[model samples]
Target: MPLVETAFQVVDAFTDKAFAGNPAAVMILEKFPADDILFKISREFNLSETAFIVPKYEGSTHEFHLRWFTPTAEVPLCGHATLASSHVLFTQMTEKQRQSGPLRFHTLSGELSVEFKTAAPEKLSTRNEMSLPELVMTPDLSIDRNVLCDAFGITENQILFVGSCHWGVLVEIDASTTPLHAIKPNFKAIASVNASAILLATQCGTDLHGEYDFISRMFAPNLGVNEDPVCGSAHSVLAHYYANKLKKSEFKAFQASARGGEIHVVYDAVAGRVRIAGDAVTVSKGVIYM
Candidate 1:
């Protein structure tokens, strides 16, 4: 087999500083290789997700094509990778593309948009905004509480609410009693929870004086990721789920993984889309010869 060398960059998404948020390896290819090849490259990077981008003029909001792959599978939507891609485009691409308006990425999840918020470099991190995937309630979806308890290492009483969507399952835990970030899940038991679910995200609200409005952690053992540092796609579910429960539509969310990150989320009911905004920084640049 002939070895193909693909240039790649790794960027930590959803954080202004390096090594804080989720890291995604990005490859800007002329055209995508076969799926098996993509999987092999993703597995080598061993990150939560790798984003593949191709420049094209086919779509309505066309500047680039986007896709996300985990070590084990290709996911339909990924927020942090998208953030990293946007960071690459604005900072590394030609000046013309940077000056161009909000970028429209043709993805498996459909047309998603991301734009640089400011012309100045210093304030750019405040506004790398991307309109993300929508949320859905999988009606009548059920998972055993004991199964969840075993997977997350929490008692049945700590599981406050359980909900499912096409993307993953969302659970509200009682942070008032148990410290939300202190709970360490049993990764080996995650696969035993539910075969249908791909990701498991747990969340809780902060006190009145807390730094953030809400805090969450995501796990996707089925997808070969024990914990996702800062999950953008999961926030699409969290934003709406908490909105209905808290009777609000916007928030500052914290992902409580060891490599923490902050996200600003807005649930735009009128448009039926969730807007997740965060900052991304490039940590390293390299090439992967596949």
Candidate 2:
């Protein structure tokens, strides 16, 4: 096959500094490539997620079509990657388009909107509104508490709440007693479990209690991400989980990964949507020939 050239940019989402948040590669293509090609490209990048975007013409409602792919499989929704995609698009746009209202994206999860925070790239941020995910506990399908602790390398006393959500099993640690950032998960064992994914969180303790409201980390061995540095989509579930636990709709959240990042979240029960807001920084721009 003849090689085709595609433009790409790597952006760190949910942070103002480069290489600090979730790193996602955005491939700006002229048209959709074969599924095999997309998969291979994602694997080649070997990042947590890669976003593919192209101009759309279905209607005046949407300006572009966006898709997200992990190293192993395609996903219906991805938060950090979506934010990175918006950063790339906003930077590439003409001053006129940049001045327009929020850009609309057609995606598998549904139509998403991202408005530029300001005209400057450094001031740019993304506000993604998504339907809140169900965070109900499934006692029958849930793994034993002990087993989950073993997989995450934590003690029984260290955990506070364990349940199931739309993304996977949601576990909340007692950060007051133990540190959330010190956890080292057994990824192989996590993948062997029945759950499709796992999300662990903790309400910030003395260390970050005042600085941030909550902290979290996501693991999806089945999806080729052992620990997602910063997951934006997962926050939709967090927004609902914390809203019920904390009795509030607004929160400042931090992802407790090595490359940590923060997100500002607001959940509107009546609207049935979680609005996640955060900044993004472009790290590199290049062309991918394939």
Candidate 3:
């Protein structure tokens, strides 16, 4: 086969600054590529997730087809990558091609929408707001507590709540400071769990000094991403968990990874959705050869 060249860009999601958030590769294709091709490309990029965007003729004028792939497998939903895709459409797409209304993306998860809050001229990034389905979590009684405790390097008592969402397992810890930083997950132990990702969070008090409502970390060793710098999808579950716990619908969160990033979430229990808003910065633009 002849070399097929395609354009791809890297965007740091959930943060306005470059190299500080979870970086995702965005590829705009005229038509859907083969499944194997997407898998290979995602593996080559080696990011936690890569978003593929293609124009959709059906439905609304703003409709587009979107899919997300990790290095290992295709995921059902990815928030940061969806934000990155909208960032490309708002900042990179031609004015004539850009939609005046909200963007409707048809993905495996469902019809998702992204609304641009602010615009910059030919800039590195844009602020886009997206609402994802609220994941209802249930007590994670299936997994062995000993295995989870070993994976997280924490005692069973430190775990306040253990729950499971569609995306992964969520563990709420009691300590907000040193224990959060001291987490050194054993990847092997985590893989023994039932989920693909492990989201660990704690309510922020004096540690964040009211800047953020909570702090979190995401580990997806089974998905080939040991530690996601910033995870938007994970926050969808976190938002619901904290909103009820804190008795508030709006919240600010900080992902305490090495390359930290911020997220704002609003949960609407009646609507069964949560809006996740963040800023993204474009790092590089280039072509991929396959």
Which candidate has the highest lDDT of all?
A: 3
lDDT per residue for candidate 2 within 1-290, as digits (tens), equals 98777788888898878779899999877689899999998998999999998878643323788999998898888888888888887776676776677777788877887766643455444433333332444433356877877788878887777777456778877766556777788888788877667888888663354588888889999999888999988888788888888899999988889999989898887766777878787888888888
Q: Candidate 3 lDDT, tens digit per residue, 44-131?
A: 9999999999889733346799999999989999998999999987885566656477898999889999988876556576888998
Those runs of model 3 whose alpha carbons end farther than 4 Å from true positions after fitting are 58-61, 93-99, 121-123, 206-210
- lDDT for model 2 comes to 0.79
lDDT of residue 45 for candidate 3: 94
Q: What lDDT is obtained when candidate 3 is compared to the true structure?
A: 0.86
Clashes of each: 0, 0, 0
User: In model 3, where is the ten-residue run with the lowest total lDDT?
Assistant: 174-183
Instruction: Rank all candidate structures by their TM-score, best first, as comma-separated numbers.
Output: 3, 2, 1
Per-residue lDDT tens digits for candidate 1, residues 154-174, read 777876678786687777776
For model 1, state the Cα shift of residue 250 in Å: 1.3
Off by over 4 Å in 2: 58-62, 122-141, 206-209
TM-score of each: 0.90, 0.90, 0.93
lDDT of each: 0.78, 0.79, 0.86
Residue 226, model 1, lDDT: 82
Score residue 28 of candidate 3 by CA lDDT: 86
